[model samples]
Target: MKINFDKYHGCGNDFIIINNLSNTFPKDSENQIKKICNRRFGIGADGLILINYNDKFPFEMIYYNSDGKISTMCGNGGRCVMHYCYSNDIIDNKSEFLACDGIHHGIINDDYVKVSMSDVNGYEKYNDYLFLNTGSPHLVKFVDDVSSLDLINISRNIQKSNRFDNGVNVNLVSRKNDNLYEIRTYERGVEDETLSCGTGAVASALALNILSLINSKTVNLDTKGGLLTVDFNKSNSKYTDIHLSGKVKKVFTGILEL
Candidate 1:
């Protein structure tokens, strides 16, 4: 079978997006999914996204990590899929879709897509690090120098430390200024350092806010891949109106044979 897919990216995070509205893709075939994401043998990507038809919403987003596993919500993936929906007329400039996390709303602004993330009720603090789930579970720590840290080894160690049984996306962030921060993330499902991570970015920003490290409600994040912005409203320790925005582009369309 030949699977037609489109490639898209938000910042540097890329995905293989397929239109699964007709249910043509065999989602149960984990091996096939893994093959399709193989960098050398298939369409290389950080993850795969399926835009499925939904009765309650405009569409449903089903995301899978490149490892061929159904993972948690992805912020960058959400933005890219929303951009895909807009570009393909699956939605207008704005849309509402159901994802693994819950219902999410998104809007397209030229090349930039803004996605409204779910509210975060609380977080756990361990020494200088903070842990929270912003669509996906994340462990956030503010470092003195983000670029100088040994990201892979450190993140890998903590992920396997059994501190988080389900594992967590680890984010190393450094305050660049009052409203801006630099971040490097080791995503859980991908099990590697990605160019950028949407949920990780949100978790890092919220963690900074919770620690009173930032004076602005809107936080700017610079990753190895590109720049992303997160805006939110906090009330009674609950974060609402959460929006993650960044540049997204459709790279190409291709057919993968299996």
Candidate 2:
């Protein structure tokens, strides 16, 4: 089978995007996606994404990690999908889209996309970490020095720990300065420290708000790969109307063989 795919990146977290609205591919067949996203033996990417039309919204998206399992909600994936959706006329310049989590609205203006993610209604506290699910599960921790920690190794250990048996994406964050933070994330399915993670960034930013590290409607985040901005409204320590803003860039296009 020949699969048409487009390569896209939101802050250097690259993915192979496919428009599978026709349902030409079987619903459960994701093995090929994993093979294609393999770094060494296949077309390298952080994961694979499918943009398909749904009766509920302008479009629906399915996300898979490099492991090829249809995983949880993805932040950056949402932004990139909108970039293609609006650009391809699947939706107008601004529209509501549905992802794995729920209905999300976004505005796409050329290279910039402002995605409105779900509000966080709950939080789990730990001496060393804060746990939250923003569409996808995330474990946020603060380190003495962000530059000195190895995100991959630490995240792998935390993900496998009995504490979070289902596994969770891990974010190591540091307050770079007032109103700005630096974050490094280890994604679950990718099983490595991706250059950027939208949900992870959102989790970290919200955690900061809960911890009183920053108090503002919008937060600036500097990922290892690029820049991402987060906006939200808070009441009684709960955040709502969360939006992630960043440069969702297009890299190239290609056809994959299976």
Candidate 1 per-residue lDDT over residues 1-258, each given as its tens digit: 887899998998999999999888874877777888888998889999999988899899999998898889999999999998898889999888999999999999999999999999999986568989999988899989998989999888887776787778889999887777999999877889999999999999999999898879999999988999999999988999999999999999998787
**Which segments of candidate 1 are over 4 A away from where they belong?**
none
In model 2, residue pairs whose N, Cα or C atoms come closer than 3 Å (at least 3 residues apart or on different chains), thus clashing, are none
TM-score of each prediction: 0.97, 0.96
Tell me the spans in candidate 2 whose CA falls farther than 4 Å from its real position. none
Residue-by-residue lDDT tens digits, candidate 2, 1-258 = 787778999998988889888876556667877888988998888988888869878878889999989888888989998998787778887898888788999999889999999989979975589999999999898766788987788777776677777788989898888888999999888988899999999999898888788868788999988999999998886789999999988888887776
Compare the candidates by lDDT and give the number of the best one: 1
Q: After superposition, how far is residue 175 of candidate 1 from its true place, in Å?
A: 1.7
The residue pairs in collision within model 1 are: none
